[model samples]
Every structure is written in C-alpha cells, then in structure tokens.
Target: MEYYFITGTSKGIGKALTEAILQNDNTYVYGISRNCAVKHARYHHLHFDLSDTTALRNNLHKVFVPLKEAERIVLVNNAGVLGKIDYIGSQATDNFEFVFDVNVIGPAILMNTFLSAYYSQQCPKIILNISSGAGKRPMDGWSAYCASKAALDMLSLTCQKEQELLGTGVKVYSLAPGVVDTAMQAHIREAESDQFSELERFKLLKENKELLDPEAVGKKILQLLKQPQQYSSVLMRVDEI
Candidate 1:
C-alpha cells in the first residue's frame, strides 16, 4: 500500500486533496493540520503548528519511524502562508521572515528529515511542494508571498538535484495550483484597498468564475503520484495538467 504525508489538511486545497486521496482503497494519509478534528478509517490526523519547525520535524520523525519499516513514502509539503500584502520597500521584515519560515525553510527541513529516514529503506519516494504562480511572475504588492514561493521553487529543484547526486529513487517537484477559492484568496481580497492592486482585475476574475476548483487540483495531484514518471524534474502548473 502507498502512503502519503500531507500538511495543511484542515481546509481549502489541502482538505480536498486529503479526502480525494483517502478514497483510494490501498492508500493511507497522515494529515497534519493545526485544527484537524475530522476522523476517518484510513486517515490519521495530527495537530501541530507549522511555525514551530523543530517540533514539526520531530513529530514527523515519530510518525514515519514505523511507516518507513513497511511502505513507500510520499511527502507533500502543502502548508504555506501568504503574508500581508505590501510593497517590497514598505513590507515589514517580520512578514518576510515568517513567510520564509513556513513556505521555504519548513519544507526544506521536512524533506531533509524524511529523506534521511527513507534513504536506507530504498523505497520509491517523492516530495511535492505546493508553490504558486507568484513564484514564476512577480506581483506588485505580494512581496513576501512571491519571495517565499520563489524560494520554495528553488528548494524543490535543488532537492531534486541532490537526490540525483545521491543516486536515490526519490523525485521532487514544485507545483502551482493556480487561483483557487480558498481562505487565502479571501485574505488577499480583503487586503487594504490602497495597497492591493487591480482590485477590479480580481473582481472581474471572480465574476467571470475563473478560479479553479480545489478538488480538481487535488485529483491532479493524486494522478501525479500514481504516475510520477510523467513529471519528474519540472515545476508543473495546474493549468498544464
């Protein structure tokens, strides 16, 4: 049986993805969220804050210690923070630092920890990072968000290279899920009117129903995991799949 370790499963795309994956009869999902109360026969929910990186790392080690003995591992680093909207110069340093901690450093550390345990097992493994289009193209007021995603993209690419160097079967990719209807979008829409750009653009997009469904993205993720050979070394966008 294949096993998936996913984060941010409390809501939005993460929640949808977790449910979709658990539908498979041979699948087991370890979902990490700050507020995970949902119970299922095949799902294991663990509550922890991503802000505490060391604690998260330790907890993940504990979770995988037994699983590593039996099955293959797939790590999905999906939890991320979209910091307050502000221009580059006007943004607070704390916002940038916090974003990096959640988006970049946390995932990198998790990959390192998981790989250290999985290396000896020689199991087929993959790390999927939930990145954003902001990483590919800059947005005027999304300084922290854009930078954090950019860092995450690089981290995934670098990890893939390192895996190749070690001659390990593990593969990694950073994926952009596009604009989805999530609380994160609500936060962006409610940002200070003056600081946010193209409010009309967002409104028009919303009115035109341009947002992708979270479940659709979740299914695509499951497809990727099932047939990973199709996406081994590149950063994939949801639109492309």
Candidate 2:
C-alpha cells in the first residue's frame, strides 16, 4: 500500500489533492488539518493546528504509521497562510511569526518526523512542499509570505542534499502551484489597493477566469509525482509539470 500524509486537507488544493489520491484503492491517506472535509475508507484524518509546533511534534505518531508492505510513502506540506496583506511596516510584527510558524516551521517539523519514522523502510520516499511564486519574487504587501516560502524552498533543497549524502532515497521538492482559484486568491483580490499594489490586477485575473482550478492543479501534481525522475530541480513550478 502507498501512504500519503498531507496537510491542510480541509479545503482548496489540499482537499482536491486528497480526493485525487484516493482514486486508487491501494493507497491510504493521512490528512492533517484542523477540520476534515472528506470521508473515505482509506482516508484517516488527524485534527491538529499547524501553528502549534509543539503539539504537532508530540502527535506525529498518528501520522506516520507502520505498514505491512508499503510500496511508497509521501509527505505533502500543503497548509499555508497569506499573512497580513499590508506593507512590512504597516503590519504587526507578530504576523511574521504566525506566517513563518505555519508555512516554514510546521513543514520543517513534519519533514523531520517523516524522515525519522521511515528511516529503515525500504520504500520510495517523496516530500513535496507546496510553495508559491511569491517566494521567488517580491510583492508590495506579501513580505512575510514571500520570505516564508523562500525559506521553505531553501529548506527543501538543503534537505534533499542531506538525503542524497545519507543515501536516504528521499526526493524533496518545493513547488509553486501557480495561482489557483482558492480562498487565498479571494483574499488577495480583496486586498486594498493602497496595501497591495497589484490588487486590481488580481481582481482582473479572477474576473477573467484565468486562475487554475484546484482540482486540476491537484491532479497535475500527482501526475508529476509519477515521473519524478524527469525533473531534477528541487524548486519547480506547476506549469512546468
């Protein structure tokens, strides 16, 4: 059986990804999130707040379970928050901590747990961090978010290097899933023009129906995983897949 532990399974791309992975009867999914939105025989939901790093670390045993004959294991760090949508100085300093806690620190802990849990398991291991294009570029009001994702990208790359040195057979990737039509996008569109310089552009993208569908993006990610060898870069974009 193939086991996949995914974060943020309550909504958006995470929920879509979980549903897509469940299409196969031989696969089992452990979803980590505050709430559950899917009901399936192979799906196991674990309720936890990603921001609470201490609780998450203590309860990771529920996510990484032993399998009789596991074919593969995967970790998808999909949960993220779009911190305060204002210029750096205009937003509260605490917002940076909140954003980093959810986006970078949470995933880092989970990745560590996954690696340690399956240290001796003789199966293919993959870690996919759901990053954003914002990480690769600077935006007016997205300083915290962009910085967090950039940190995530570097973390994934550094982890991949370590795994290679240790011969751990782990493939780590930090991928940007483009602009999906998720609640996050709605939040971006609603940002005030004074805070976010590109507010009108984001609104136009939504009005023009240019945003990628969450379901489609989720399926594409799964397809990309099928042939991981074709891509060598640790940092990637969904469109490239």
Candidate 3:
C-alpha cells in the first residue's frame, strides 16, 4: 500500500491531492492542516497549525507509522502563507516570523521527523515541497513569502544530498506550481495596487480565467510523481515536470 502525508489538506492543492490519491483503494493519506475537510475511510486528518511546532512535534506519532507492507511513502509540504502583502518596511516584524514559522521551520521539522521515522524503511520515499516562482525572483511586496520559500528550496536540495550520502534513495524536490487559483490568490487580489505592484497583473489573470485549477494541478503532481527522475532538477516548475 502507498502512504501519503500532506499538509494544508483543508483546501487548495492539498485537499485536491488528497481526494485524487484516495481514488485508489490501495492508498492511505494522512492529512495535516488547521481543519479537516476530507472524509474517507483511508484519509486521516490531523488538525495542526504549522506555526505551533511544539504541538506538532508532540503529536507526530499520529502522522507517521511503521511501514511493513508499504509500496511507497510520500510527504508533501503544501501549507504556506503570503504574510502581509506590503513592502518590507511597511509590514510588521511579527509577519516575517509567522511566515517563516509556517513556511520554513514547520516543514523543516516535519521533514526531519519523517526521515527519522522511516530511515530504515525500504519503500520509496519522496519529499515534495510546494514552492513558488516568487522564491526564485524578487517580487515587489512578497518579501517574507519569497525568502521563506527560497529557504525551503535550499533545505530540500540539502536534504537530497544528505539522502544520497546515506544511500536512502529518498527523492526530494521543491516544485513551483505556477499561478493557481486558490484562497491565497484571492487574498492577493484584495491587496491595493500601491502595496503590490503586480496587483493589476494578478487581477487580469483572474479576470481572464488563466489561473490553474487546484484539481488539475493535483493531478499533474501525481503524474509528476510517477516519473520524478525525468525532471531531475531539485527545484522545478510544473510545466517542466
């Protein structure tokens, strides 16, 4: 049986992926998020606020389990935040803290925990971090978000090298799922043009119905998993995959 652990499963790509993976009778999903939005016999939801590391660490037993008959184990870090969508100086310091806590620190802890829990397991293991293009390029008002994601990309690359040295065969990647129509996008749309220079561009994307759908993106991710080696870059875009 295949096992998948996903964060941010209450909505967006996380929720879509969980539901898509559950269509198979031989797969089980452990979803971690603030709320439980999925209901299925094989889908288990663990309520978590990613910023609360102490609580998550204490309750991690519910997330990972021994893999006796598992075909593969996958961890998808999909939860993230945009923080305050304003220029660097205009945003509160706490906003940066919150963004890093959720985007970098939380995922780092989870990846460490996952490796520890399944270090000796022979099943194929994969770590997919939901990254953003903003991480690769500077954006006008996404300082916190971009920095956090850039950190996450480096983390994933480092882990991949570590896994290689250990001969663990764990596949680690940070992927940019370009422009998806999610709650985050809606929040971005609400930002004033003065604060976010891309305000008009984003508005046009929404108006033109150009944003990728969560479900379609989820399916594309599953397809990518089937042949991860084809797109060998540690940091990749969905189109390249």
* Clashes found in each candidate (C-alpha, N, C closer than 3 A): 0, 0, 0
lDDT for each residue of candidate 2 in 1-241, tens digit (9 for 90 to 100): 8999999999999999999999988899999999999999999999999888889888888878887788989999999999789997778989999899999999999999899989899988899999999999999999999999999999999999999999877999999999999999988988889999999888989999999999999999998777788888999999999
Residue-level lDDT tens digits of model 1 in 62-107: 6565574445689999998888788778877788778888888878
Worst 10 residues of 2 by lDDT: 59-68
Residue 192's lDDT within candidate 3 is 89
Give the TM-scores of the predictions, in the order they appear: 0.93, 0.98, 0.97
Model 1, residue 117: distance off in Å is 1.2
Write down the lDDT of every candidate, Cα atoms only.
0.82, 0.92, 0.91
State in Å the error of residue 140, model 3.
Answer: 1.3
TM-score of 1: 0.93
- Scored against the true structure, residue 106 in model 2 reaches a CA lDDT of 95
Comparison by lDDT, 1 against 3, better one: 3
- Candidate order by TM-score, decreasing, is 2, 3, 1
Please, what's the RMSD in Å of model 1? Answer: 1.7
Instruction: Please give the TM-score that candidate 3 achieves against the real structure.
Output: 0.97
Each candidate: RMSD to true structure?
1.7, 0.9, 1.0
Give residue 86's lDDT in candidate 2 (0 to 100): 96
After superposing candidate 3 on the true structure, give the runs of residues whose Cα lies further than 4 Å from its correct spot: none
Q: Residues 48-97, candidate 3: write the lDDT tens digits.
A: 99988889888888788776888989999999999889897888889989
